[model samples]
Target: MVEAQAPLKHGGWITFPFFIATMAGLTLAAGGWNNNVIVYLIEEFNIKNIEAAQIANIINGCVNLFPVVAAIFADSFLGSFGVIVISSSLSLLGITLLTLTAMLDPLKPPSCETGSSFCQNPSKPQLFVLYTSLALASLGAAGTRFTLATMGADQFNNSTHQGIFFNWHFFTFYAATLVSVVGIIYVESNVSWGLGFGLCVLANLVGLVVFVLGKRYYRLLKPQGSPYTALARVVVAAFRKRKELQSSNSQDYYDETQKGQRNIVGTTPSNKFKFLNRAALVTEGDTNLDGTIKRPWNLCTLQQVEDLKALIKISPLWSTGILLCTPIAIQISLIVLQALAMDRHLGSHFQIPAGSMIVFVMITTSIALAIIDRFLIPMWQKLFGRSPTPLQRIGLGHILTVSSMAISALVESRRLDSARSHKLYGNSAVPMSALWLVPQLVLVGAAEAFHFPGQVSLYYQEFPKSLKSTAAAMVAVFIGIAFYLGTAVVDLFRKTTGWLPNGINDGRMDNVYWVLTVIGIVNFGYYLICACLYKYQNVEKAELNDTNSG
Candidate 1:
């Protein structure tokens, strides 16, 4: 009996290399196309600068958003490994199509030379193929990125190991993105778009092959039906029993499947969301003779009730991320436009790719992650006598984000001055160096190093066991929403103010940065409030002591 109950040792540090390699390959493939897509549209598809930014924003929104749906599917039906395999194949197919478009002249719009007055738009058939390719690639990238995070973390039993994995996971992701943005974007810009996209196809294939090779060593979890369904039942059951008196006795609640399983000590259904207790109250006809629920919609288990409450409690904190990401997303898109309008020369022979300016953020983030993991955390523990919590790290992220926005405003102000002084307008490059954008980018990267892994750690640790996949994808969800919101904000600015004109040299881009700074400041205050009010639902005391110890 003891041997039968003993756990199988299927996953450990042994799976680490495969997961890291898989992440590096897939992230490089995704970044290769995604990073340079705006430029691709403008150069190949004859899209206007502002219009291309909007499309890029929308594409980015979709790429991040689809992960949530993929996570749900992984949690509900297909497991993470299966979803990743399918998504990787889809990515390969999509990138291959993208490569063909770059290679076949007929598939592309007529080339519009620099300073040309006239440009031709892509045909309807061309647009259809382009959109289809983008959709598939976005969906494929979405499914693998966050789902892989969850699956990789699942291989570990210790919280410390899991935390370390998340740190290195994001490090690998950013480092791969840096490589793609620099190397692949250079190939697309200086060499051939066909060759660049062809490389993405190869990367995707390699990632898929490497992941499949580690199948036997993975800690595979089967789908235990949809956890979302259980959450919905909790809400419905609570609504149905709204008028019922809440019970104080722990035994009055129906603890189905696992007896005495309480989220809070000495409280079966946590007191914070007391009204939800009625959902698990053992009322008449709520259960059968065998103690199973008769009608799930009318009566849920105590664990289910607690799960819903946990989500509700964390929602405000989750929402803070939306605003945190919004300004960053908008800035990222606008920086490309800024880079295009500024001097991009490095020495004399080499000119930096406008689209690759964001790679500084990736480079800084990768370096920061390594430094934070190896030196910062250990020093912090020794000095503070304890490791920093996720909320503390997130608070620091907010502060740095606000600072970055301020810096962006100042830099944009200088760039606009230089542009106006030189009388540079209508897509002409300003005399000022594009390197002025580096400080803000560096700060933003540092902010991400703090918040991204912190949020991943918090969500994974706090979320219910059944919703682990969804938890891993929650950061992606907020980032997607932020990108969408960023699009709306930019659109609003375009319509209401002359601040973000097509040619920013003819507009007040500094004003846009100032507005984002204000938004960041306001959002930071809200995040502080949310962080203070929230309590961890699933974090164990032992885990706190062991955090980042690995």
Candidate 2:
């Protein structure tokens, strides 16, 4: 029985690398949009730092949240194909608006265009249009990101497949980020910023078309998901489950197919459940204990509640971890830099591209994640009894962040010195070697590679099976917090410390490193306390995870 079902369930062209590749492309596109747009928004909006970061935080958090919503829809009503198509199409529309914003004559800011001092205040109408466009893009991002990864993982069935799902899951994940590194560093930083955004929107369009082309042969998992019910159902299932099992010995086992799903009922947000059979990714539809009549909801079933609790708690660790997002927020803050005391000239090209530091940060950080996991951890495990946990990796990641900030402080202090010596020019000019940015960017990327994977893995594993999409959504939530906090801190700094004897404010692009570096130090300490409390799972527990997902 095992042999017969195994090959068919696990291996096929659906597990083909190409299918995974296409899915990975969507992930890259979503992340690329999240990443590249920040730099431009900050520049265009003349926004405060915290206000700027709110953009990234809001977009990423909502993107993460919508997945749970989409997952429910997919499992219950919309099939995977339907959701993927809609999400991808929405992304295309959102990106088009962004493209229009970018392609404006002389590429104007949200409030005012280049070479114009006409209006001091852009109305709510303009802001509303921009927000509307961004909001739609965010919606598309949230749904597509959730489904694409889940779908990619679904491509392999663990019971009979030779495809190493665990490996491929992370492999596709890392591969997608590799593309983000390119988008951040090369596309956004190296190319015309508008062109970078244009590509992001275009990628979504192409992805939708291609996904349609391949739809026929794909094995749409019979969506055996749970309904989008409220938390009360989880409680009822536990109570009834104990009653049914009370008559049996502790060793007694019940096949999931033997019982019907626990009955659930609800309205809008507040819902409830009655005694019903639990559900699974795929399950036997029989409702009676004797396996008589068969019926099941095509929604995510609560298969493993005990395991899910452990997973959901890990989200706060990542709550503030996507530090690369800060740079995204900074693009808008650049206008502040220009207003404060920066010199935009290259200082002979060796000067750092202060505005573009995040690009290098994301690239190197992703590379570091690959190196630490594949190479460094193996070597360390051989030498020591332990391989690094996600918490450990996060700690290591923060060290780089802290260091990046410290370096920024030193750089800013030096710039201040140069200005005092009359060697430094104005706020819109560059003073130091662009190479000075390498360490900060590289450190940021290293931090990312180390923290994000395990953090994401922890979130998915910790949340109850039915809530994978929702818990994964939490990873983006902290980033939102981080974004808001970062922006707020910057605003405060600019208003308070923005001024120096030379008329420089802390918002100067060069001086902003000082801000990031210091904030990184503080963020690192907080991450330390959080990491200590974090509980994680081992590789052995993954299979049983299926047994308990409800």
Candidate 3:
């Protein structure tokens, strides 16, 4: 299977540098604009602070949501290589438009004077250009991120190498993002937005060129049609044969998909979700004389039934991740608002960009990944006779997520107290240093280090082989959903309480963090229950430790 899929001459270590370079350029370009969009909307488009945060969250939701669609296209039609090429081109076009918006005075509203309550909004034409640019760039980014990971993983036949690739994949991802958050955001904040966006355009062009240059080295996979249709057929067949008697004999079940060669034979389905086994009962007239199914929707292969079962079983654990990520999303958006209202000076020379506060999260996550991949996993293997499992890592992430939110609540409380003491209100910067916000950001970063890659590795390892790209994309999909849900959460606070207002200093931002902390705690408890109940579907216990524990 390995040789047939990727001829030895085509894939392996030779493709690594190309893939890594492409990922670095693309991620840097994406982070350049995405990281500072809230500030752009506020400073250039004259949007309100809270409304800008909401818009940022919505944009994030779209960016993440597009990955799943991209994944589907990669798995069903374009393949990862083709998708990357097209998406990278689109990204280039989008960033060029964005640069123009930053350069042209007519494309933005007039800047508001300090301490003014009134600010003119961007004209309709300006907004149209802005949103169109954002949409194209976001769509392009969504296509590349996880689909690229899947493509990289496809280069290796060994599961261990694939796991290592995933580790480095994210490390590189966060590291590039760190650079953009610090460098590009500093330029946007301290210098000119036009210059900053121009740099992004250049990065996007380079990334696209580098990716296309590696075409020959890639071991591109052919699309396998839509895996969703196969899964759907399983459900339809199972429902059609719901009343059929159960078959205990292995041969009675249809495993014809594996009939051709080797030592494989018909296999009995597991006891769990056994009701679905009716789909593969091999009843009369189900198969023709040559053994093909006469009625496609009335019968399915055992493998198909098992694939659907795998998805169904793991769904509970998957859902816990949504709530787990929601708090982080909310915290991230609010952190920018907090930074804007606090003293951000580093010594006397410079003030940190409010948007760049997220750099701390990226830095810590990258450092954490390095430690986990090198020291921690290795040390655990020597002491405990096994490395930590993905579920264990994700469990730790859940705990840290809650801890981070608690710390955020505490920090926000102190900031609020300082604001009250100083009579800071309505865009007045508090005397407190923004450095106080670092602790919570660090914790959130550490939490992401554990869960984000863990979730990706888990899905890739467990999902059916035909859905590899989709498996890699599941994490992005949930994170996207979480961002949308985070927006709703913010709106809920706005509608129901005085927690979030246009001037955060004048409102109860601390209460918002406290509420989020409580939500995190409850969600963590639910995650514990789900994790405890879940079982590994594809890899054996020992194999999981060997391949994915890192």
TM-score of predicted structure 3: 0.91
Tens-digit lDDT string for candidate 1 (155-248): 8889999989987998788778989999999999899999999999998889899999998888888765668888999888889999998878
Residue-wise lDDT of candidate 2 within 140-237, one digit each (tens)? 87676657656655655553552355456556766676566454335665566567667776666666777777665565665654533524443444
Model 1 clash count equals: 0
lDDT string for model 3 (379-445, tens) is: 9899877777888889889889989988888988898889999888876788999999999999998
Mark the regions of model 2 whose C-alpha exceeds 4 Å error after superposition. 1-11, 14-57, 104-124, 158-198, 226-232, 235-356, 419-426, 457-474, 485-550
| Per-residue lDDT of 106 in model 3 | 90
The whole-model C-alpha lDDT of candidate 2 against the native structure comes to: 0.54
Q: For each candidate, what TM-score against the reference?
A: 0.90, 0.68, 0.91
- Candidate 1 Cα deviation (angstroms), residue 351: 1.1
What are the C-alpha RMSDs, in order, of all predicted structures?
Answer: 4.1, 8.4, 3.2
Tell how far residue 253 is off in model 2, in angstroms: 16
For each predicted model, how many residue pairs clash, with residues at least 3 apart or on different chains? Answer: 0, 60, 0
lDDT: worst 10-residue window of model 1: 1-10
lDDT for predicted candidate 3 compared with the true structure: 0.85
